[model samples]
Target chain A: MGRGMKRWMLWLPLAVFALLFAVVAAGLFRPADRTVRSAMIGKPIPNFTLPGMVPGKPGLATATLTAGRPHLVNVFASWCVPCIAEAPQLMRLKAMGVPIEGIAIRDTREDLLGFLRRNGDPYERIGDDQRSAVQVALGSSGVPESFVVDGAGTIVLQHVGDIRAEDVDDIAAAVRNAK
Target chain B: MAALCIALAAPVLADPSTPPAALAYTQLRDPAQEATAKALMETLRCLVCQGQSIADSDASLAGDMRSLVRERIAKGENPASIRAWLIQRYGDYVTYDPPLSAVTWPLWLAPIVLLAVGALLARQSFRRRPR
Candidate 1:
């Protein structure tokens, strides 16, 4: 190979390496779609009847979810860190008159009460899901998940993680769309 | 794979009933039902762990899912129908093997095409060499 040709060939490898690096870096920096797959997006909530969190109160029923208005079904656990982080967001939504139902997964009432005491209680009703049967029925995967349901009981959207302050908009939009 | 074998063995240990209270709590019995449960669990991804099958995962959520599968099996429900139900609820991610479709075609095709291109480039380079 000619001297000039050899120099040009050397540049080709660097150019290719740079191109590959850019491709990988772009993929790394770009925000990936983190949404969990949910089959219940347009489907009605599954039937479940969970015991009430507090004494002398009615246990939560699937029938209550379809009560002719949009509502939020939030699955949480006192042990889940994100649940505690999202507590403020739940309270904010609660203050704005959103009817939020809670399902406490594998948590004791004492821990739940302590959680509420520390973070403020915003749930209209709480279901003790000690065995996670209700969680399975709802096709839920983890804690601090929120589902936006329409008046007809169809799920519109699912927020799969802790509801940060910015997520309130998405939740609000989901609720509006549910109606 | 080690993962698949381990996943298949988990349902037996996860049974809630019978002697040995130390066994993981689930309401499934019968070898036929357990086999069905194990097979089904092998395909279902543990949503909590995200990297392992429900059978391979020791997460409490995975245990619940195994129990759910066993319950469905006992109710005479077809495993395919149960898989469909979970896919409908959890999306294609719930299954380890996703169906090939418009979006997934590239996932199935890109590697082969890339390999061909690599071979063609290698041949051209070899032909240009003095050796």
Candidate 2:
């Protein structure tokens, strides 16, 4: 190879490495605001009216969840281990008299009922979302996600992971602010 | 390559549960090999869809991986040995849940170490620079 060709080959790998580094950096450090903005702030609450776990009983409907009062909506699944971890925290929220609604995504009736029976039912009403239509509407990446809806039915805040005791205060504050 | 093309085209032409008519004529119809192929595909990563397994992804690369897995299984390679071969070729990046070991130390600890170093450097630089 000529001296010029040798110089080009050295630069080619360097250019490739630089391009790869840039792509990886972009993946790692892309703006969190853009990724989460739609779900967390100023998005309309998800509209859904799914059948309840019980055959005959009236299932929870999104129409029942209104903009008239501040409410919390929890998205959980029976298969999700983290949902189990957050069950007691949800019960604590119920004990504190917080109005909590639940959206059960892609889970069987038996599994959902089993979950409720094992962990005390904190949900005022629950929606059975087997197809994840509500999840798509809410733009959720995964469960367990929680949304705080304002009196105007706007989703004001969202939590992506299991709720801890510290998060209770923030959620309560959002609920108060929503009201 | 012809057999691979047939296998690749099989699922697209017919329902997955139904064996392809073309494949029905072949003497290499081994159920164990089919299972091994499926298992390997499920375990492999789809490079295009980083979050999806090769079996779950609809990407062309996933299709290629599926075809490759099928060919290896048909060649009488065990699924475990095939998996080991892939791990050697691509490292643990091919597996979604890589085993925790010295190889994974950077992935597990880089963030904390980066943060600590950044904090220390920030303190030192800011102290000297009067920012």
Candidate 3:
């Protein structure tokens, strides 16, 4: 190889290494989003009618979601620890007049009642999702997930994980926008 | 020796936490239908346990998914249609095999482009110089 070509070849390895380093550094600095954003957003809520988990409270149905007001649908279970953590925040939202609905996944009545008694019951309607059929149909993968449904029954937002104090405002904003 | 073997096998036989199999986890009676459902399940990514496919994951959600797949397949729905249904519900993330879309086109093209570049460079370097 000529002197110029040899000089170019000498830098090629360093160039390749720098390119890889840059890629790695970029990834470290700006990590890829690991959260799965549900595709069901902007789509109408799936049709489902679950039985009442708590007595006297009516069961949740697709028609109830379209009751001409935006509301929050929370998927939780007595077995999920995060549900307890989010309970206070859910109560806060309920007090704010954000009508909240509940889907109790794979939970018994006794456990659910105890959980509500210990924390606080803010749900307007609590549905029993014994087999996670409604949860799966809603594209919810885990407990403590919440969705903001507009008056038209379209899902405006899907918030995975527990509703922390910090997330309350954002969720409220989403609920408002859904209106 | 027998005691040691029994001790080792005891743990295997005493899995108390294993949940009862869901309705769909039970294979279809017809071997052909079961095979078809199994093949489709292997391609579905479990939303709960992201690492394992629905066929391999023991998550209750995966079982539910497996049941849905088996039921649909048994109803004579093709695997492609079932896959489409899942993709529609969960987006492209639910399938191990993502179809080529505008965002994924670069991934499909990069290998061929890289190979062509390498071949061109190799030819230039190894070509015999005119005497």
Candidate 4:
């Protein structure tokens, strides 16, 4: 082997190690996107009429979603902690004249009542997704996910995880764009 | 060891008449149909657990998925159609067997490419060795 080629071969192990370390470190620091972006986005909302979760509030349905106005559909549960965390933002969105509907996943009537009482009810219509069929149909994997639906009933944007204070503006903007 | 073995085998030894606890967890009565559904379930990824297939996961979503698969299979729907339905709703992430796509072609090619490079390097090193 030539002197230069032999020297290069001697450093090959170190070079390989460094390259491997760089790839691993990059992965460690900036982890793969764990959030599942719903494939249902841009697709029209599936047809279903969910019974009202709480008395006096209306039940949710695809017909209502497509009723000539943009709105927000929030998938939440009384048992989920993050749902409680995002309650304030939901209320803020409601205050901003955003039409917010809710899907209560696997929650009991009593629990739903209690959750609403504790965290002021921001929902105009609350649907009981007792078996999460609607949630699965919407491609929602977890509680506290929200989607912006346009007047045409098409899903415009999906916001996974809890809505923080900062997300309020973005969500409002999405709803506006849908209009 | 004897006690541990008994503990592990306890479930199998339990009374068969005990009704299934969850609707979704219940297996089909027909062995052939159940077998087909189970096979398909093993190839489905659990959205909640991420690492576990729906068959191996105890997550409620997995159970729901299992129920959907079993119900569809009982209706004489083929596994491919059922898989397609789930992929449509949840995207390709739900399946363990990913189809070739623009983004995923590299994943399928990487192993063969790596092996070819390794073989070429091995040949070059062998030729350079002092006899």
In angstroms and one decimal each, the interface RMSD of every candidate reads 6.7, 14.9, 5.3, 8.6
Task: Please give the lDDT score at residue A12 for candidate 2.
Answer: 86
Candidate 3 has which clashing residue pairs, if any?
Answer: B24-B67
CA displacement after TM-score superposition, residue B128 of candidate 1 (Å): 18
For residues A22-54, could you state the per-residue lDDT of candidate 3 as single tens digits?
A: 999999999987676677888999999999979
Best by lDDT: 4
lDDT per residue as tens, model 2, A1-179 = 47998788789878989999999999888833322222335856656678887454456666766748888889887777788888998888877778898888767778778878898788877887655556545655456889888887888887877898788888877887887
> Which residue pairs clash in candidate 4?
none
Per-model TM against the reference: 0.74, 0.50, 0.84, 0.84
- Pairs in clash, predicted candidate 1: A39-B88, A39-B89, B16-B26
In terms of docking quality, model 2 is incorrect
> Candidate 1 chain A — worst ten consecutive residues by lDDT sum?
A53-62
TM-score winner between 1 and 3, please give it.
3
Q: Give the whole-model CA lDDT for all candidates, comma-separated.
A: 0.80, 0.70, 0.85, 0.88
**What CAPRI-style quality would you assign to candidate 4?**
incorrect
Enumerate the candidates' DockQ scores in order.
0.27, 0.02, 0.27, 0.22
Candidate 2 residue lDDT tens string, B84-104:
655643456676656668888
Candidate 4 lDDT, tens digit per residue, A66-141?
8889999999988788888999999999999999999987777887898899998999999987767788889988
lDDT of 1 by residue, A114-161 (tens): 888899988878887766778766778888798898988888888888
Q: What is the C-alpha RMSD of each candidate to the true structure, in Å?
A: 9.2, 19.7, 5.9, 7.7
